[model samples]
Target chain A: MKIETKVEKFTEPLHLESGRILEEFELIYETYGELNEDKSNVIVICHALAGSHHVAGRYADEAKPGWWDKFIGDGKTIDTTKYFVICSNNLGSTFGSTNPLSIDPSTKKEYRLKFPVLAISDVVKAQMRLYDRLGIKNAFAVIGGSMGGMQTLCYAIEHPTFAKHYLAMATTAYTRPWAIAINKLAIESIRHDPIFKNGFYKKDDLEASGLPGLAIGRMAGLIAYLSPGLFNRKFGRDYASTDGLYELFGRFEVEKYLEYNAYSFPKIFDPLSYLYICKTMNIFDAGRNKDKLADSFDKVQGKLHLISFSDDMLFFPEEMEEIRDIMIELGKEKQVTYKMIDSKCGHDSFLVEVEKFKDYVSEILKD
Target chain B: MKIETKVEKFTEPLHLESGRILEEFELIYETYGELNEDKSNVIVICHALAGSHHVAGRYADEAKPGWWDKFIGDGKTIDTTKYFVICSNNLGSTFGSTNPLSIDPSTKKEYRLKFPVLAISDVVKAQMRLYDRLGIKNAFAVIGGSMGGMQTLCYAIEHPTFAKHYLAMATTAYTRPWAIAINKLAIESIRHDPIFKNGFYKKDDLEASGLPGLAIGRMAGLIAYLSPGLFNRKFGRDYASTDGLYELFGRFEVEKYLEYNAYSFPKIFDPLSYLYICKTMNIFDAGRNKDKLADSFDKVQGKLHLISFSDDMLFFPEEMEEIRDIMIELGKEKQVTYKMIDSKCGHDSFLVEVEKFKDYVSEILKD
Candidate 1:
């Protein structure tokens, strides 16, 4: 299916969890399938960091369908034909949304570091406003993984009756210390780059040289997103070429693979947006400011399905199990389901190993 | 046990595995305890990346002991009372050995990137030369962990009769793709820094500014050296400061910990040495010229003990098991012993959690 991105303008101030406000902003989103007359078949899809509103379907000019095209086509797992899927580009994301790269209405200049720090809850609130404007009173389901999963949980807790089913995949209820350290590495890597110019580099300059520091950050982040088993199976000890084995700058097949994927990232993605998103992820504590962690679960009225991958080191299966355990302790196990899928793809399994969880998703949608 | 570093000059040409030659070089080493008559009590210790000859005891100016002081002092696991310990800085390391920072005799300039890419075999050979000069023949044991472990394995294979026992811990026979990818991240992180100046930055400039890029690399490397379980237990979701929770650049307790450790690394470590060592590690294949991996182990004439950590993501327990399994397949099971120590510290377990394996070392030394 071919789809077009749509933008909606809102003048009302968006009060963020950080106590900052975004006075005027635009929500960029895409929809798949048609909205049913009753609008009960709506499914809101949240995107991870570096992800966009284009979750599935093809554009007129692109060859690749979407980041998650595999599970959302006509007869695919998500079955776009039955459900009207809505995915809005997250606030602070670089993908055609009013992010750090967007021109500030008051200053008439790019926000850059001037953009207020965002939280997962703030991003969810912005999306909720879009949902309100789209006339989506009560959606059939809400689905996401990673940072998106955090947004899904916020939706379930903060707005208890918005979505009937909430599917959070490969995520944690809060950003743990291990993951926080990883994010710090990425941010510092970008910050150390001279070309970054304190996040005020010209777009043309960034396009010319590309942020090597950002590339390094991306490379490190990519490794965390993948399992060592997957890497061992994919590249082993293979060389990039035969001649440079003994050279100081020799390339391994794995290094080449990472470089190819990482180096090209900075050319398209904005550095400030990347930095902000990392902060947003690091401070994601669902139970923050609550007397008890179970209090966060007590507010959830939706059927919360926490799906995790066995090999995901960044957000371990135990993290998702903690959410379920909290719900169980609160005698709300009937409202929460936790499933850990066997996968070697690690955290990226949610996007690439859809077959492992598709039947379960179909069953949930059936309910 | 107070110790001082000693340096010895060698005029003889050292042929490297890369077919390059070091015409003249200096080896820096340290010794502890007493060398018995006939030098039969000699125990050589190999240090890993960023490690030096200072394997035990304290210098006059320092308050802390050596990196492995816990297991190397008198009546300790290695038992200095019964053995004389020797540790030499590895060939491309920055710790007082002739590394990239060393002056090239021909040009009177620092070698920098001109330093020949070293293999683990080259490092072992250099240590062997130091052993010969010290009048130590067929020492009781050769021991090390991580890169040091790689050197121990090299000693077992290349100089089979050099030591009676070889103890290699938390290491691999070859640098697999997973580790190669990680090393690439570190090298690239330093390379991306503008101040790195392609490894030619002036010493004064480096001292003044410090390589932020190198710090980022170290931060990433440190995380890999430790397990997520350790980080969770140590830092959890604690904040660096309570006031900056919603700030974009607010630090987590984990971030502060990493920053404190990582930022100080570049001040002392050389970026070029870091890059060269990473390269050396990536291309370390024991069976490089051999027809089969088993052929490399076939030359082992001494008892080989392979130790691994349960939570080591860098070098998995399965990797050490592979070495033992290869020996068993060759009908040389009697020649090798494999032990996996349960620890949450990951690769650093061999260094910090020596108590867990000290008794085993005592038993092995008794033979």
Candidate 2:
């Protein structure tokens, strides 16, 4: 269960939907298992917001394994023993990816807000280039959840035959107004931080200076990720201090939990990147020019699998149902499979309900 | 209709559940209609968090009517022609109440963070005192919704015989963890605003300085106040400018709406008061010391009417169902009435759907 990140530099400029270009960029990725002689058993896994490319295994000096270690390991659902798995840090992300926090080649200074705005399609395009560099002509499957799910759909729509299977969990083809509203708050939280200095704050003091705004944004996001039922069962009106200390500020257990995670988020995350990434999510619309979503999926040749969580407030199960209905109307029912995971974990269910998807994943990967 | 705010000063010290005291505080209230002989037709209305004593009618030079003007005028739901109405701002609020922004007589300065933490019972106690000063020994009914609804329940429980009828809408007897989490974000947003200066911000610069945090907090609260369906129906993915003029921000119609309201909120609200009021809401528990919720209601000798919004994410309809079940178990079902308003407006349904409640209110008021 050891993992190491590898970086690849692409000299070609990335033309963004915003009409901006990144002259050159690097993509950091992690690979599990070895590519076969035919390189036919490759699976590309996408990460969500606040997630990195380290989908499985532990890096040296790390206390915890990768985010999806439970689901993607030697003998896990996406068994590494049988297939080559690749997960890369998305563009506009703060990991090892060439994001706003990365140094600008011309100025040797951080891009900060100067970085080009990204779209979900741009993220998929970068990953597609990474695969091409590695000589992966076609991936056996592209699997992801949440923002990752958005990427999976984008990959299928853009490349069509590049991936044999596309599995999207707890995501929508188009961003809903409810989600846009939430993302707006997160962006405003960071922008309102005086220390943000319009996203030009001192890089050395980034964590301390913009921590308040970034933390607030992260707290709101965490609440959206969790279900009220889960919150009630886990921390229902429970006081954090039995001695009546911190009563005015940190009284509830749920408040303390949100505070801790929020405050710690800026330690590793960049506020500018957070704003950029969330803005990308806010404008995500797969069928932007099409009259109907089914029209966009017409070009997709990959087998489509839509997984939705019943308790997810962000990408509600009904939104997933719409996608399923569209596919049926297009007479692509044979190529589509829709599964709803009854859960109380909300949008985070895709990350936490690994066991529930074991049989589904195994069956999908069998071919 | 015309309205005027009146302030009543009580020299007697108000003792709080937190063991703190507010010496010589003031209560701001507005009256609509006329109190009949014996004050038997008097109805005490409670305002929600961020609401003022201005519940009905218009003040001098005002362009807009009070928050509930539509429902409190002569021919409205809470008809002024039939019932004498009184609405007061809560103690820890900015609207002419003795809040954190109120002056400390001894120090001759704003109380700021030095203001004692308030409880829902404390808010109810202050209102009860206001009724005493008004010479209204007993109210015919106490009716309110949302945080105001919480106050209605508190009024009925703490002063069981003070009111003959109790109407609570879109609220719970206890604050849920989900609500606590949302309140925490709002509080954090204000506290993190650098201009807040730990609540010692300059009084003259209050609106301009603490606006960022307060606005962000309000934006979050507004999102919670609305349901996803309402947002979808009202705003959807419609952009503010079809010409793409405001792409970086202010893109979505919902985002623009949230931004406008969030920004304007600080014009009339104090950050400290917002924090205090939300905190008061977080600690609201009607059955604090009781073995069961039914035990808390045992002393009640009034007809109970509970109305919940079907689409309210904050106080779900199930929460109201819990109250109904408890009353039924206690064999008080005959005295208890529960109704759910099918709405897509979320927690704001109580405020927005007044026309729908006209018949229901008329029937309840007949007694």
Candidate 3:
């Protein structure tokens, strides 16, 4: 069931760490539940790649509920009755936030590629301004998975005193070579398209971005989502038939699923947006930011819950263990806990797998 | 030192098991060493995808040496002084063999895609005829890797008494789902190319049947020829610094290798010829012809040597072991020896890995 939530547009001119001032920084967000008298029940929900502020409910008359609606209802993991939840579209996101498609006040045109390349830290920093404006001193917990997990770590490292708990799920501290390679291929798919005009094309021409090139992008993403065991389970050279006509007709169900994903991406996503967001995500490195792992975690004043997935090849389970190991070395062991969720969905288990993730969430939050 | 070999062409009209008469089946081949008195020293080397009869030494008056020059000459593992070696370009191959690009006796024009869709067995059948015509009673070994490996297995199954040794490398009894999936994508790359014309385009346009498609095809092949460890070792997301002034460059040396292979293929290869040859290789199945594994090997003339490389994601080591296990089951255990090469090069180790392959050959010959 879709929960009811309130959304309001809050615009504030914020000074960036860079000397330049974003004169009209705007934030779009949705909120659920009531704040306690001491405001200690406030929980922050962060998003991974391609997520928006619509976290738990129907936006007034919209039929489609939020992406995380399954996990944020009254009795869900992020229970609305116990915690006041807030989710916002980060500043550089194409969702409701001011992004490349936003008009620059000085030039009065879409920033497009002209928008300054954003880092996850920059995104987190912008959200901090939103938090300050909302009078939230510290969130009871900051929880996220995948790219959102990266943002949670960045927030905790940057403003540890303001975060009581940090739960990171199925994420890496920084992007790796394999992921960057896939990202490069994905971006190249769009840029090399005959009609892709480097983001200046009209909205009508933008639809072409999803055809063959974007289809390949979705394919690349699918590879990271599923496990080899899944592939083995589904199709093991069991052809449709022996006449050479059956395999010719349709053999592997995996191929059909990939085609579906490729066909669907263009309707919901823009190629340029994918490019920009990928770059921002890649440059996000908390250890690099603070010079060392210990230094990065030292500033954190929050409990860290580092969660990994057994089948997450994109962000390997070993990487998550490394993060936990680092937190221990930094003498923050008391504030840290590591949980691993075993699933066959690989990197995409966080989003695609429901029941298993729900059970894991229940166990993690029980204490 | 390079050993000179005589090259010649032979043609014969053969009746296929399919009840179709293959008339004037032309074969271009090279032979080294004098035939033994009993025609029993013959070692036939089957070519893999896109390879030819020039297994050793350069063509007469040619600038470039043959593919396996380092391992196939004089006192090599096969030992030309004691053994006669024959390498014939497979039928349906673009190399100087009877192919779609060759003139059809019926039409006088290139057969194009009209060439009978071939199976791996067909190629072996034609080679067997070549053997019979040459007055060879037995082959010392039928050795090959990849598609060539398919032929080795086919030779063993189809004429158990003719080939005494089956040295199959980097191949399977049948094409697995992973290989078929990649091959299907490559075919789609060629078929969906606007210039393909469903195999009935203008003669000049037929040249365009698969240019850019060559990229995807070779890219897929390159994946087979590489190990993930080797690719990660060699590439690891290293990229050329473009400075945003020119088109993006390939991310890794391996990617560049694939691009070069892709570009090279379209320059020389006939699109229809590629399709026919790959299709033959894809459907190659020794397992399909016989019910039990022993029934499949019951016809094999002699010993079997199965070789695989470590870290070969394409022809996974697991599949190679399966063939070896089957060979051991039927009291042919003494005749079958399996060796897994410890190399990071993966399946391509068969080609670029000269010293190791040569050593293995010497060791096997000593046995």
Candidate 4:
């Protein structure tokens, strides 16, 4: 299947949860399948950090399918043939979205660090605006994992009737302290890059001198996303002779794997956008102003399907249990269901363990 | 009690496990209590990464006591009244020891990156040379935690009769892949600092510009050294409004704590030394060059006391179990004992939860 990205411009001034306003912004999105006459068959798919509008299918010039290609194609778990899937790039991401790389109309220059700080709710609001523009009054479901899951939860709470089903995978209603510490490390890594220059460096210079810091941040994040069991099983004491001398810098395969992924990340991702997104993630609290999590969930009328991986160290299963227990205590047990996927892939299980959840997802998406 | 550092110079070249050699080096150490006439009452205490010779007691001009002062004073756990204690700065650290910051006699300049890459065995060997200089043929016990524990294990395995008792705390006989990954991040953080300039920058410039990277590295390492329960209990989402406005960079108490420690680290630590030490840690495998761990322990003759924290994520109790199980399989279980310290302090429990283990230490050290 082939897909193309489309842009929707919201010219009206938009207010952000951070109390900052954007005069105008554009959302980049891709759609699959046909929308029903009532526009009620639309499923909004939110992307995680580093993900983009391309959730499934390949573009004409692209060699690879979308990030969620396995689960969203025809006859797949999401079954694009049965539902219209709309995946949009979140705000503060560099993937053709209104992010730090986007130009500021007033300054006629890239926003860079001047870009408004965003909350997960802001990203959800932008998607809701896109839905309104596309005549999607009610979505069949809102589904995502990690940062994407944050958006799904936000949509379910803020717009109770906007979706019939909400699926959150390998994520939490609020960022925990440990996760916040990891995010802080990543943000500091980018900020400490000498060429970052307080996020004011020229794009080329930033990419040049800032890539190492970005790579280091990604490496650190990757460690959190993986389980020790998986790493040991995959690369236990296996040495790679880097210089043919079998000496210092001769690395274990897992270390090489992390370094490779981290080094490659800067080629496609912007460090400033990464910092902003991580900051937004760090402040994610579903019940920020509410008295408790139960109160926050009171407005979420959509049936909730919470999925967590057993080996996920970043968003542990205990975190998912916290949300489930809160819902149970609020007498919302009938409206919520929790599932734990037993896998050694850790937090990345949401992306890699699709086969493990294909049947459960299909059952939940059924009419 | 007031204590001071004493240096021991080894003019003979030291050979490292990495096939590198140091022409000459010095060990900065501190001692408490008097050596017995037979030189059989010495207890060698190894310091962890970032730890120094000041294991106990305060210096005359200092406000704070040694890092492990609570556990190593006159009548503390490793009581100085009964056993003469010697704590030496490990190779590849910067605390007045021969390290990357030390001068090369031939070059008349700091060794910097020119310092030989070292292993735990190399550090143990250096300490053994110090013992030879002091005319101590055998030690009553070799005790340490974390990297210090690694040294204790090395001393036991490499010099079978050098110590009568070996206590390894919150550490492993081999560095796990996950640990290597974390260490890699720390090493890369230091190397990526542009001011590091491949470890050739002027000392002042390196300290000023490279401190952020060093701090970031420390922050990352600190995360592993703590448990989530401790963070939740200690700094649970309490926000600090910097600049009198809750905005971007407004931090949680935990973030501030990590940042403060990270920022303060460079004032006393060297990035090159950090990298070298982390590299050494990454290669710490007691079974290295041996077909199996049992083969490595074949020569070990000391009575073993293995201690692990229940909540230590870095060196999990499972890791300690692995070593204990290996000893059991080799019929050395009678010579070994294991203890789990139930604490929320994680890897730092060995240092902070001294009260929990004072009696245990005293019992084990008693003749």
Candidate 5:
């Protein structure tokens, strides 16, 4: 399927969880298939930190299909042919959304760090506004993974009667110390970059000199994205260059891979957006009331599916199990389903190892 | 067990595996208790990255004891009262021994990147030289962990009859892609630092402005050092400061912990030495020849004990298991032993969770 992104402008002020405000904003989104007469077959896809509205199909000149093209599209697991699928570039993301890179109306300059620190719930609220403008009352499902999964849980809790099903993959009910530590390293890397200029560096300047620190941060993130087993099997102890072993700055095959992907990231991503998105993830707490995690599920009116990968170091299966256990204790076990996918792809299993989750998704969405 | 580091100067040039030469060097070491008449009860301890020769006891003005003081003392696990314990600073380490910070006699300047990329065996050979100068032919055991473990294996392999027991803890047979990827991030962080000045920055300047990039790199290293389970239980999702949750650059309890430790690292350690040591670790392969891992063990003349932590993300149990499997296939299983310690401290379990391994160590060394 071919895809085209559409933008919607919202003039209303968005009051964030932290009491910060986004005076006005725009939401860029893409839709697959067609909305049913009553819009009962709507499926909202919440994108992860780096993901955007382009969830399926390709643009006219694009080389690769959308990020989740395999899992979406016609007759696929998500089955966009039968259900209208809508994916929006998150509010704090750099992907065509009114993010830190967007010009501020008041100062007529880039928002940069002036952009309000967003919560996962704030992004969900923005998506909710988009749905309101699109004349949708309720949706069949809200599905996402990682940070997207966090948004899914926030949406389900904040709007208990919206979606019929909430499928959160490889996520946690709250940000833990382990995940926060990783996020800290990434944010610290960007903060340490000389060219970052306290998040005020010109985009062109960053592109030319390169955000080497950001690239390094990306390398750290990439390491956590996949499992050690996969890395050992794929790259092993191979040297990228013949004389790498003999040189102090020698490039291992894995180093080369990380560098290529990491360096390329700065060109497409804004450091401020990356930082803000990471903070949003760092502060994401579905059950903000610490001791009332079970109470948060009391009013849930949808089937909550918590899917996790066995080897996901970022969001361990045990985290999802904790959430499942909480729901079970709350007498909502019937409404909550926890599935652990035996995968060797770590956190990215939701993206790269979709084949393992395809049949599960197909079974769940059969109706 | 009062410890004082002693420096030994070597006038003879040392040949390195990378075909580079150290015109002359020094080995700094610390000894505890007395050496037996025949020198048969001597135990040589190999220190890990960032570790030092002072492995036990306290110095005159020291606030804390040595890194492994808990494991080695008058009546401790290693039993310094009965056996003489010697811990030597590795060749490329920042602590006392000849390193990148040391002046190159030829140019009369710090070696910096000019320091040869050392193989683990090169360090073992230097220790061998240290042993030769000390008039020691063999020892009771050679014990180490992490990078030190690599040295233990290299020493055991290179000098087959050097020690009766080779105890290598929480290390890999060779550096894999997962490890190389992590090292790349750390190395990239230092290289990306604007203040790094291509490894020619004045030491005073680095100390003044601080190596923010190095600190960031240290944060990454620190994250890999401990298990996620420990982080969850220790730091949880608590905020370091009351206003942290509301601010974009807010600090979580975990972030604060990482920042405190990571930022402090640059004050004590040199970035150049870290780079060289990381390179050493990346290139460490017990068997450099492909498909000859087993062959590298052919001349083994001592009992090899490979100890691993169950949750060590840096070096997994499977890695040690692979080595044990190789020994078993070669009918040398009787000579090689593999022990897995159940601990939540990850790779640092060898240093932090000593109680769990104390009985095992005591039992093995009873003879």
Candidate 6:
């Protein structure tokens, strides 16, 4: 636990829906940009999986802009100079934000597995608090990528007054059976891990599921991050280098990179945070409304832009078309438009393949 | 551990450049075509990773052809009526071949990790025995795809007298750094798995490194097998379902397809065999016969047709040009030709992109 006592929380006593009372829930967040005098020029930027409120500015160090650092800089997509951009590290974030890893206050111990299951609404509610605190009556835009996109869609429906412009990037409204299987396998790798000790073990157990599970989980996530061709280009069948010809036993260089990356992740991310985030993704159902997503879209009063990657396997383009179709059926087609960017990098291409992503971002934010 | 008591050894201790002794080895092979009366028309059809000897015949429930069933059938690439075709599983294989998991006469238990690393030469030697069994005095051609291509190059260099025509299809003479990296990661996944127990564990330990390692390993290999854009085009972040709901649960159809494929891989592959095959590829070097590759007209005694894909990240078109330069330098450009096929499917396209793989095969065979 790298302590960040600076975190503040607001409790929402209970929001009953899924049969369990999410009682006295403490939600945490962080922000960027200044609130305009009118507070109407607000742009809420949602973070994707492993994202946080620290989208811009320093978080103790010379923090590089956010993960979307390139898109949300000065005079860029979410130009801070023209708009008040508000971002939050969702309630279940592993960042300094409140999460399952946070102390329960009642027990004075970390929540761990005892934390209540969270829905996307929980995160939406958390942001609502920040909106209430800042006295913001409406948002200029609510933009996000991947899981952040899910939030953008949810916010537009759950609280239409908050977002006038909605941008969902590389996101799906719900988890697919295939995606769930991979997540399940990853979670199994963690839970069945010998070190997990049924999630009751002390935090120091590295040999257990924490590192290995995080490593495997990240690997699975990492696979989703890039295109198959990119990996093949980066690492072909070349073996690790050897100083001497006689060295028979040696690894290839690419192997070293994954190992190093997987090893470091466990330290930075909590197992419980991963669980909550995945659960949030799994439980997301915008179509649960009476008319399903069509009704959900009917409630939203915003210009919806659904941008997807041609190479994103995690959220295939077909599903996005489904979302677009539903919105269009609800007479939201003019407000809802979709574009597919071509790239060989798969899901992560939005974050990588910078020039392509940059062009799209600029086009969307163009005056 | 599916017992096949009929496995036979080649009855020769293969001598390799590396002093490591592979006590004895065997060849798992299938044959097609007929040898010419002069024994001058023998063609060796090499198979890639995860391929087998049942190239074109009915082997139990697997009806289709063997690995290259179409390319070497009645009127295929190496037409049986015109040449003798031999497809042999590599020495360190698990497909009804002498592999690491086979029972070690010395220890009584399956050799598992104790199996000595085998090389491309070992695969060649095993094939040579099958050739000798069929009394092949000279070969008309040696052909393969991907890993099979690596073997084709190795066979050409080691026994110049055996292969006079080399049709190297979408293969690299040497495994590049990228391929090695991906494979190393796959291997590392297995080696780090405690269930593997450093390559040996109780037979009952079904949930060991082999499952996840093999699953991820094979899936990782898929990076080389398909184009990034194709996956994206088919799946791009489409939600996991056709329903307009967003429940943070489950996966998409394409993911389910991949899982279905990966599920069968662990059962069919041996962890140590995967490790050893990589070692063979790592030691692989086609630079040994630079003169022959460079000057197809000079010292070279065989006809060369090197084919590559424009979108292939593993074996780039630039590499095919490298092979072409050698032929051009030797003034054997006419004897050695090269072509880059346009495709959206990556490396594995050579196998599934039949019309393309077949056209090249037919063209090469005709000349």
User: Total clashing residue pairs per candidate?
Assistant: 0, 0, 2, 0, 0, 51
Q: Write the per-residue lDDT of candidate 4 for residues A1-367, one digit (tens) a residue.
A: 3355799899988899878898899999998888888887788898888789898888679898888998897888887787899998888888887998788999999887788889888888888888888877898899999999988889888988988999999999988889889888888898888777888766777555346778888888899988888898988877776451225556778878988899888888888889888888888999888988879988879898899999998888988888889889888898788999998888988988899998999897686
Candidates in order, interface RMSD in Å:
1.0, 2.2, 4.7, 2.0, 1.0, 5.6
The best-first sequence of candidates by DockQ reads 5, 1, 2, 4, 3, 6
Error of 2 at A332 (Å): 0.5
Candidate 4: how many backbone clashes?
0
lDDT string for model 1 (B72-149, tens) is: 988788888888888988878887888998988888988988999988988888877888888887789999999999
lDDT of 2 by residue, B194-227 (tens): 7788888886777453467888989888999999
Per TM-score, what order, best first?
Answer: 1, 5, 2, 4, 3, 6
For model 1, residues A1-367, the per-residue Cα lDDT tens digits are 5465799988999998878889888889998888899999888899998899999977779888788888887888877788888899998898888898888888999888889998899999898889889888999899999998999999899988998999999999999988887788779888877778888877777876477777888888899999899999999888789876888778888988998999989877888888999999999999998987789989999899999999997899999999999999989889988889999899999999998999988887687
- The TM-scores, one per candidate, come to 0.98, 0.97, 0.81, 0.96, 0.98, 0.76
Q: In DockQ, how does model 5 score against the reference complex? A: 0.85
Return the top candidate by lDDT.
Answer: 1
Question: Mind giving the per-residue lDDT tens digits that candidate 3 earns over B1-367?
Answer: 3343433345566665344556767777778777878888888999988788888767669887777777677887777787788988888777778887777787888777666777787888888777877898888888898888889888877877777678988888877655665555456455544455666555575354345554555555665566545656776544444332112232344445455666577667766677776677666667765686567876665778888887565667787898888777766788788998887787778877777877877777663
Q: Which tens-of-lDDT digit does each residue in B1-367 have in candidate 4?
A: 4355799899999987767788899989999988889998999999988898888887779988889999987867777887889999997788877998888988998887677788899999999999999999999999999999999989889998999999999999898898888888887887778777888867778555346778888998899999888888888777766441225566888888898888888888888888888878888899988898889887789898899999898989999888888889999987788989888898999999998887987787676
Check candidate 4 and list the clashing pairs: none
- Candidate 3: tens digits of C-alpha lDDT, residues A1-367: 3243333344555555333456565667778887778888878888877788778877668887788787887878788888888888877776668777878787998877776666677778777777777778888888888888998898888878877788888887766554554454456555544445777767776564454555555555565556655566666655444555212223445555555666577767666667667766655667763567678888777788887888775677776788888888988889888888778777777776656777766665554
Single out the weakest 10-residue window by summed lDDT for candidate 3 chain A.
A245-254
Q: After superposition, how far is residue B154 of candidate 1 from its true place, in Å?
A: 0.9
Judge candidate 1 at residue B286 and give its lDDT. Answer: 87
Higher DockQ: candidate 2 or 3? 2
- Runs in model 5 deviating more than 4 A are none
Model with the higher lDDT, candidate 2 or 4:
2
**Global lDDT of each candidate:** 0.88, 0.86, 0.70, 0.85, 0.87, 0.68
Clashing pairs in 5: none
What tens digits encode model 2's per-residue C-alpha lDDT throughout A43-120? 899999999998989877899988888899898888888889999999989888899878888899888777878889
In terms of docking quality, model 5 is: high
Question: How would you encode candidate 6's per-residue C-alpha lDDT over A296-366 as one tens digit per residue?
Answer: 77887777788888978677887688888888888777777788888777887766665676666566655
Q: Give DockQ per model, in order.
A: 0.84, 0.67, 0.23, 0.63, 0.85, 0.18
